[model samples]
Target: MPHIIIEHSASLDTDFSQLLKSIHQSTIDTNLFDASTIKTRRVAFPQCILGDGKTDFVHVQVHLLAGRTQTQKQHLSESLLNTLRTLLSDSVSLSVHPYDLDPAIYRKN
Candidate 1:
């Protein structure tokens, strides 16, 4: 079970919707989380203050119900970023965070 939260500035283009869809697909392809359990949220950043230089800064927080090996996390991270870069403009910035669940809770019995 992995949940992804996306926050972007209001100035960001509407194309971001497509980007989110792509992210969802990529996550499903990874087989890291149940597609049905994946939770996503997109929020518009306040425009009063200038955004952090880019149309938006994306923070991808992944919560893995099953503990992942280091290699698995690395591969997932790389794949996620690559997919994001392909969908977003070069000017946009992206950040990803992968969290591994505690073995006690995540290990498959």
Candidate 2:
């Protein structure tokens, strides 16, 4: 199972619902997970400061059960990052980090 959590600055003008759909589709394009199983959500920071105080940001963290090969993980990360690059402005700080959850401890129920 994988959970896509998106964190962004509230000041940024973007449609998060569409972003979620785009990311979910990109994840499906990787052929790593079923479309029905992918979970996506977003959290906007209304009060926060970026490094330069003028930069807005969007950071995506993908958490999944640990087992995927490094190449697969890298591909997932790059694919998601590329999606962000196309949607967000150049001035926005964008990043994608894929985290492997311990399969032994991760539970959905």
Best model per lDDT: 2
lDDT of 2 by residue, 1-109 (tens): 5899999988889888889889888988999987788899999989777786556899999999898999999999999999999898888989899999998888777
**lDDT (CA) for every model shown?**
0.72, 0.89
Candidate 1 C-alpha lDDT tens digits along 51-103: 56655566576777665878888777777788878877777677777876665
TM-score of 2: 0.93
Each model's TM-score? 0.75, 0.93
Residue pairs with colliding backbones in model 2 are none
Candidate 1 global CA lDDT score: 0.72
